[model samples]
Target: MQLSTAVERFLTAVQLEYGYSEHTLRAYQRDLAWFIDFAEETGARELADCDIELMRGWLWQRQQQGLAATTLARNVATLKSFGTWLERSRLVPGNPASRLRAPKAPRDLPRVLADEQMRRLLARVEGRGDAEHPESLRDHAVLELLYAAALRVSELCSLPITGLDAGARTVRVLGKGGKERVVPFGGPAARAIDTYLTVARPALIARAAQAASAASQSAASQSAGPQSARHDALFVGNRGGKLTPNAVYRLVARELEDEPGGGPRGPHTFRHTAATHLLNGGADLRVVQEMLGHSSLASTQVYTHVSTERLAQSYRQAHPRA
Candidate 1:
């Protein structure tokens, strides 16, 4: 069988049988597509021609090109899975990438804001939010919920209004791999979300409707086909469409631009901050794992490391002994 044909079949099987998420599917497709091209260029177009040395050469070529270790590791993992699938489906006699090893990607500690920094950030957002400015109100709620729930940006953007139990102060978040978990927030987040829903969301919806009506009446408007279907998403963009991850990234980056952080300034920083804060406040590791919707406890152990580092830093700053 052609290597490319086997890859397509493997992808289809994973998508349908394993229920891989869109992001994971895309990563697999990208990594495998590159491998297929490299294999063909090296005169290995058939599934039987692919071998461990060829796979190693592919990874070596990528390393020479200065790809990050994490990216190269993912490429190795993609090939391993593809090779295993090919062998299992009888397309190849054996798994060529069975012994392939991914490079040891450095596990950098996630960036987390200090307690004072978080307080100031929330206060600034709260000050900007008022009934007169709906977007500000939305922003306030967004920041509060992000910190309180430690939600991924995708989880937050895809959150449906019905998913929120305001009275219970709990949100039903659809996390990665379509796993659903209910995470609770504090009174401040509850109130901010409530205020946004009551004042901001309705106003934004009305504005969107008005804009659609106006655009329909204008002959030069290129977007005169039909108004977007009403969505139940908790968050909407300025244009009243479902809020995108890019918009959330911009919101978080702009807010954290001046804060004391060395790594990424994206919304996951809030997640790391929230996790570290929870661990700092003596929350159980298992509980934090459940709240963060991590399938493995190992994934949650990183926060413990962050908490320990923070403790040592504070001790160094405050202790009197040399």
Candidate 2:
């Protein structure tokens, strides 16, 4: 079988059978595509041409090009899965990448906001411009729910209108691998969402309808009917479409541009801050794991490290004796 053909089949099988998320599927596709191009360059176009040596050389070349350890680790994982599938399907003699090993990437602690910084940030957002403005209300709700639920940006953007329970102060999130979890938030988030739903959402929808009508009128030859369908998303963009992850990223980056942080200034920073704050307030590790929709306890343990670091910093500053 051709190498490219084998990769397509493997990707399809993973998507259909394993239900891998789009992000994971895209990563797998990119890594395999690069590998296939490299193999073709070396005159290895057939699936049978792939071997342990070829795989190792590809990784080595990427390493020489200065790819980050985490990226290389993902590349190795992608190859291993592809090779395993090829072997099982009788396209190759054996799994060429079975013995492949990923480099140990450094586990850098996630950046988190201080309590005072968080307070100031929230206050600033709440006080920005007119509170009655639809955009202002929506932005406030977006930030409140992001921090309150410790949600991933993708999760936040894809949330449906029916996914939230304001009375229960909980949200149903469809996490990675299609797993669903219910996360609870505080009263502040509840109030913000309630206000957005009651006031801002309807106004935004009206704005969207007006925009769509004007577009249809200008392009009357294209269609005489409604230009777009009503979106059921919990959050909508300025044009009334469902909110996108990139939109959320821009909003977060703008908000955090002036904040003191050495790492990324994205929506994940709010998630890290929320998790660390929960740990600092004596929340249980397992409870937090469930809240954050982390499949493993180890993923949740990092917040404990953040909490400990904060405590050590306090002790260093307040201790009387050296």
TM-scores for candidates 1 onward, in order: 0.93, 0.94
Question: Who wins the TM-score comparison?
Answer: 2
Q: How high a TM-score does candidate 2 get?
A: 0.94
Candidate 2 lDDT trough over 10 residues, lowest sum: 221-230
Q: Give the Å error, residue 11, model 2.
A: 2.2
Give Cα-based local distance difference scores for all models: 0.89, 0.88
lDDT of 1: 0.89
- Expressed as tens digits, the lDDT of each residue in 1-322 for candidate 1 is 7888888999999899876677889999999899988999999998778899989999999999999999999998898888888888887788889999999999999898999999999999899897877989999999999999999998999899999998899999988878899999999999999899899988887787778777876676637533453889999877788878898899999999868767898999999999999998999999999999999999999999988888898899999981
What residue pairs are clashing in model 1?
none
RMSD of 1: 2.0
- Count: clashes, candidate 1: 0
